[model samples]
Target: MSVQFVGLKEINGPLVVLDNVSNVGYEEMVELVLEDGSVRTGRVVLLEDKKAVIQVFEGTRGLSLTNTKTRMLGHPMEIPLSTEILGRILSGSGKPIDGLGEIFAERSADINGKPINPVSRTYPRNYIRTGISSIDALMTLIRGQKLPIFSGSGMNHNKLAVQIVRQAKVTKDGGQPSDEKFCVVFAAMGVKNDVADYFKSSFEESGVLKNVVMFLNLSNDPIIERILTPRCALTVAEYLAFEHDMHVLVILTDMTSYAEALREFSSSKGEIPGRKGYPGYLYSDLASIYERAGIINGHKGSVTQIPILTMPNDDITHPVPDLTGYITEGQIVLDRSLDLMGTYPPVSVLPSLSRLMKDGIGEGYTRADHSALANQLFASYAKVQDARSLASVIGEEELSPIDKNYLEFGTYFERFFINQSFEEERTIDQTLDLGWKLLALLPREELDRLDSKLLDEHYHPEDARMFRGA
Candidate 1:
C-alpha cells in the first residue's frame, strides 16, 4: 500500500521538501495533489534521513503547504518503450507530444539506464558512412564509437547534424548497402521553436522521418526537462539497439545547453560549485552519457553516438568541451574561419579526427587505398597551410614553384572536396577518387606518404594539368 501525507515542509525553486517521509527511495516518483484537485509530478532528488527533497517536473507555483498532498510511487522515473517509438516526436520527459496518444508500451525502462559492463564489450569496427567527403575520407565514423562534433555558437553544426541524419547509412564490406536495420535517435535540448521546427521539417522533407526518433526540449521548457531530453532519447536508442538487434545512431545536439541546465539545477540545490561554478561531478555526469555508446559482446547490434556541443565563445578549453574531449573517442572540430570562407560543413581538417577510423577502413571495408589516400591528404593539407603562412609574409608571387602548386592544390581541395552542396551525398569511392585527383596537382616528389606502387597506380600530373586547364 502507498502512503499519502500532507506536505508542509518547504518549497524551493523547482524543489519541494517533505518531512517524516519513510520508505521513499532516491529518484522515486512523487505525486503532488493540489487543493483544487490538480496534480503535479516530481521525483526524489535528495534524501536526508526522514527528509526527502523532490524535484517537480512541472514547476511548483500554486501548491499550498498545508493543503498539498504528496504520495510516493515506489519506483524511479521510467519511460514507456516499444518499437513504435520510432518516427514519433516526444517531449523532453519522454511523453508523446505530436498529437499522438501515449505509447502502448512493450515495457517501461528506467531513464537512468544500466551501464554496459566493460568485460562484455566488443571492439568497434566497420564504419557508418555520413556521405560527407571530409568525414568519410578522413574521420570515418566507426560503428559503436563515440565521436563528438565541437562547434561554435553560430556555426553550421545544426545543418551538419541534419545532413548526417539524412545521409548516414550502414554499409557492408566493399561499400555495398547492408540489409541490417539502422535508425537515428536525435535529441535537441534548449533549442528555440524555430530550430526545432526546422529539424522536424528538414527530416520530413528528406523522407527520413520514419527512421528517426526525435526528443525536443524547447528553450522555454523547464531546465529539469532539459536534463531529461538526452536521457530519454538514449533510452529509446538502447531499446532499439540491444533488444531489437538494430544499429542505432544517437545524436545529441547542443550539449552545452544540457550542461548549463545541470549547473542551474546544481545551484538550486545549493551544492558546492567546482570549475566555473559547475558542480564537481560534471565530468562523471558527462561520462555516464558518452560511455553508454558501444556494442555488447552477445548483441548483434551497436549504438554509435555523435554528441554535438558548442564551445562557448569558440573556446575549446571551456569546461564543457574540455571534459567532453577527455571522455569521447575523438572530435570533429568546426572552424569559424572556414565557415567565414563559405565552407558548408566547415570541418577543420587538422584538428578533427576519428581515433577508430584506421581500424574501421581499408581492405574489405572501404577501399585498399583509403589509408594511404587519407595520410597523403593530411600531409598535403598541412603543407598548404605552411605555404599560405609563407605567402602572407612574402608575396604569393615570391613563393617557390612547389609552394605555388600547394596553394593551387589547397584552393581546389577546399572548393571541390570540403565544400559541397547540402543535397550532395558522395560515396566512399567518390571521396577517395577526389582526394587522389587533388593529390595529382602536386609534383610526384611532394606525395611522399604513398609508396611507389600507390604512386604508379594513382598519381598522374598529366591528368592534373588537363583538369586544371578544363
Candidate 2:
C-alpha cells in the first residue's frame, strides 16, 4: 500500500492536471499528494492532448501546485464480494463504513467495471410486491429488473421504501424454490440523519433487518464518498446472488444527492458542463449505477434494483429521472395530488407502468385472473376519472346514472385501492379480487378488458358487495 505518485502539473478550476500517467482510463480514480503534505484521491474525468483532467476527491482547499503529485492507481475503486458482509456495515467508498471489522471476500472487483454481457442477460419476469398498491397493483416491480421511482421533495418516497422492504416477497407460494425467497440490499446516498434512522427502524421493526444489508451514506459523510455508495451496495448484492444464491433487492434512495456529489467533484476538476452544470458524462455515469441490476444467465441468484430518486422542482423531465427512464424499465410515479388527498402511497396510477409486468402477473405467477382484472380496473377508473371531470363542471345532479356510478367508483378507487398504509399487507389474489369489486359497478358489457370465462366465473353480485357497503 505504498504511495504511487504520478506527479501533478497545474490546477485548473476543481481539476488538477496530471502530466505523466500510464493506462489512464476515463473515470479512473487516482491518489494525489499535495505540497502541504496531505494526500487525496481523485478521478480522471478527461484525457485530452495526452494530459488527464483529474477531479480531486477531497476538495482543493489549501493545496500548492508546486510539488503536488498525481499517481494513477492503474485500477478503479472496488469492493470485496462475500457473504461475510451480512450484518456488517460499509462506507460509501466501497470499504467498511460501520465500525464493524473489514469484510473478507474471496475476490475483489473493479468499481467502474464492465457491463454484464447481453448474451448472458437473464430476461426479467415475476413480481416483487412492495405492499403498496400504487406500486404493486398499478406499476408492478418485476424481479431481476431495474425500476426507477420518480418523486419530489416532501413526497413519501422514504415511506414508500420502508413499505417496500416490509412487504416485498420473492416467491409465489409453492412456485419458487424455498432457498430463493427475496432478500434486500438497501442503500441510501446523502440522506439526512432522521431519514436514515427511519429506514433502519422500519426494517428492524418489521423483522426484515436480519435479511437486509444496509449501506448508508449520510449527509454528514464526505461528498466524494457519495459516488461510491451505490457501487458498494451492488458489490454485496452481487455476492449474495452469485455466491450465496439469493435474490437481492437493491434499493438506493435520493439519487439526486449522489448526482450532486458527482457535480461537485466535476466542478472541483474544472470539467466541461453538461445540462444544469452537471458533468458532460452524466448519462454514462448513470448507466454505471443502473446497469448493475439484472439476472445473469445460468446463475441461480439474481439482483433486482429499485432505485428511487427525487426530481428537482418536481420535473420528471429533469436529467436524473429522464436519463434513468431511458436506461431502466418503466417508473412508479408518485402523485402529488394523491398525496394532498391523504393517499398514503400517492402513486399517480395512470402514468405509472411496468414494461416487465407482462412477464410476472397472471396465470401461474399470481392469480389466474390477475391480468384481466388489472386492465379492467384500469379502464374503468379511466372512465370514472373522465366522468368526474365532467361532473365537476356540469354539476353532479346533471350527470347520468352511469356517470354517477363512475363517480362512486372513483371514490372507491381512492378509498379502497390507493389508501393503504406502510404496515398493511395483501396477497396478490386479494389485490385482484379488490380490482374485480371495483369493476363490478360498471355493466357486464363494459368489462371488455377481462376474458369472458374469468368474468363469467368470478364476476358476480358478491364481487361488488364490499365496495357497495362503502
Candidate whose lDDT is highest: 1
State candidate 1's TM-score: 0.98
Q: List model 1 lDDT by residue over 218-272, tens digit each.
A: 9999999998888888888999999999999999998999999999999999999
Residue range 1-470, candidate 2, lDDT tens digits: 43455445777655777665556788776887777667887877788867887777567677666667666776777678776676655656766656767777878887655678988998987777665665666677888889888999999989888888877787664223244556888889998889888887888778888788888888987787788788878877887887778889999987889899888877766568899988888999889889988888888888999899999888999988989899998998888888988988887787778889877877677666776777777788899889978988999999998898889888888888888866688766667667777777777887888778887888885667777775
- What are the RMSD figures for all models against the true structure? 1.1, 2.7
What 10-residue stretch in candidate 1 is worst by lDDT? 461-470
- The C-alpha TM-scores of every prediction are 0.98, 0.91
Question: Candidate 1: how large is its RMSD?
Answer: 1.1
What's the count of clashing pairs in each model shown? 0, 8
After best superposition, candidate 2 residue 215: deviation in angstroms?
A: 2.0
Q: Whose TM-score is greatest here?
A: 1
Q: Quote the lDDT for 35 in model 2.
A: 73
